[model samples]
Target: MAAGNDTRITEPTAAAGRRGVLLGAASLLAGAALPFRRARAQDAKVNMRISWWGSDDRHQRTLKMIKLWESRNPGATMAAQYGGLIGYQDKLSTEFAGRNAPDVMQIADNRESLIASGRLMLLDPYIASGQLNLADANKSVLETVKVGGKLYSIPWGLAGGCFFFDTKVFADTGVELPGLGWNWDDFAAAARKISKAAPKGMYGSADIWAPAGTRAFYPFEFFLRGRGKTAFTEAGKLNFGANELTEWLSFWDGLRREGAVPPAEVTALENGYETSPIIAGRSAMYPINSSIASSLQGLSKNKLVVGTIPSGLGSKALPATQYGAFINTSMQVYVNAATKFPKQSIEFVNMITNDPEFAKIQLMSRGVSLSSKMAALVTPDIAPIEQSMVQMVQYVQEHATPLYVPWPKAGSQIQDLMQRTHQQVAFGQASVAQAVTRFIDEAGQIME
Candidate 1:
């Protein structure tokens, strides 16, 4: 959708104005150091600050794990910082610039800038010293935390993107459940048929009209992969041709225009996995990270099933890895570049990553456990969300191809542009040709 046109969609309203201010103030105090006065005075203790973004359940579980860590290792105290996702990047960047960043911070997808700016410590020496073992982690994840042959992070979990559908809903519409090797055309045809047959209030698919990296982007990425083209070169240049992207955008636009997908007005209020259309049983299919399926299942009364995202009509399955949790040298207990306690920090990191019990507690909160040994420890005791995640990971590893390491820089922006183009085309603000032309021109500038 055009930038201004988005106003018509009724963006998710901000939290009540006064309440938001109070929460913001509370967050500032909680996120900063004043509240940790007692812990700070223990000069001989190892005091670390760890920050991450998550739901209340994650925060509670992680804090419990911190308490466990402290009990097992006396004289160790960790200050916790947690927040919602919206402004996490800004908060972390500010902390880094102020040189008061937490000893352990959760790294987001923007690792390239963190590494390039020399803000992250190189973890190679620690890894070589047997501090952590990531040999069994997904290769794409390993590469995400590496720069110029040096290890700067360790993967925390495994993740993959897949299609989620309500089988009963599809069956009710007389549509066949998608099977292996169905391509985009097959999906489109099925969507059209399903829409025609579905109950009046239902849609065949949730409209994910946003560009790449937004939940809608994965299907397009899979399409590109099926064609054997990477989105970018190793040196970080845009790689797809105009025609290829335009055609893909057009397909998505067509779905929205034909009402095969939910309207943008409805989709605007939904985030990935939480989109109202899917949760409300108004849509039959959604594409999202496999890990999110459990949460979706809990929120809905319907029976949700997982399957491969459709490729081209009649094309074989072409799977891609979703995001993985990798260690961020800047966020974890990195040995300060000038610290006298590098060994201690390294040991702490090793304990966190390689310890089976610790890894199980971390679980899907960080993503999926990176070590094969740690992964084996995943039991029913882990949160149901995480247990489902483990099953999803195993399924993906069995069915999907390993994804190439994503380009470290400009990746988010590239994804943003793709989503924007998709939205514009879907809203009829721009034709597929116009959207692609603008996207390529903008992407070329940003990637350079």
Candidate 2:
């Protein structure tokens, strides 16, 4: 009943894990109470608690990896806790507050505060002492997780933002399938054409401000970078001005008015691929990170093709400018600072990240591995959808500018503000100028 404790001490079978995850999701939505257990240090034993939020596939593979780890290392025991992504932050935050956080947990894109707040174990010691291996990891990729000269986490999967188009829909609309050379103008025109041709109850595209689709701020950030503007500087400062954001919002507005994208009301219904117009055959395209490629494909029977994020004028004009897709560390593993078994935790992290055997089990379910060796290990068995994702990431690395810097401490708050104002502007609750002005003022206050 604890944050990390299950009905049984060992890992749950796949079926049991699925049931637990469903129950966890239900409890989260209903706001029902869950019993929290305090950490208990068993004397002379390496019993450690680990937790993560993932799909059933990830959960099952991770459980097998845990069992393998225990088998390989005698006198060790790992109690596992896993669930879906909804309400994960609140649950983890509660554990941290109660000083009962897991030894190892999965960290997603928004862990700047967790690192800055000193709630994560500084991983440098483990790396230096060779308890955690990173000799084959990409150094540049490794640098992305550093905070204040200390590494608090390691990437679990590497992916990039991409445009996923249903080939059949594009063909049906008589629009060219998007590829590397596609630009914003082409995108807009294609969206309009697709919307006109789509079956009833469908639109050209989903609103880019979709909260449950790609990260709400991604399209805005991509636009900024395409224009050679910084959304946020390396120092965690706001990089673009109100005028630029206004232009970005105005672009979306044009799409809405021209019927090139769904209206605010339609977009409001679902932010993810499951119910998205694109997946449901109402739209021609969906924009999301490469990691969601298979999810999109699984939900639809259409032949989906991976496409580049639509480019801006600067990328075409300069040819060498920092504008293109976002090649980013999409998922990461973080150790709880309060863990009693740091060595055991580091070992688990190392095995999952670099072990060739473990890599085979994981395949590309977590996106392409950042380590070249692990990627090679998993490449042969990779599914077609996953292969597309890997190729997409590789393409972004070769073509685009570096991804945006980690958000400042107030990054998540700023993102939420942008999502709210974007909706207001799209729905006519506020004008473009008014929304931009309000956002700049409030965001400036938060950054200050």
Model 1 Cα shift for residue 72 (angstroms): 1.5
lDDT for each of the candidates? 0.64, 0.76
Tens digits of per-residue lDDT for model 2, 361-434? 87766678878899988888877778777877776666666454667888878888888988988899999999
Which residue pairs does candidate 2 place in steric collision?
2-37, 212-271
Model 1 root mean square deviation, Cα atoms: 15.7
Per-residue CA lDDT of model 1 for 332-448, tens digit only, reads: 233334333455556656766677767666665555666676777765556554555565556545544444545658886777777778777766788889888898889879877
Model 2 stretches with alpha carbons more than 4 Å out: 1-42, 313-321, 402-404
Best candidate according to TM-score: 2
Give the Cα error of residue 364 in candidate 1, in Å: 3.8
- At residue 129, give the lDDT of candidate 2: 89
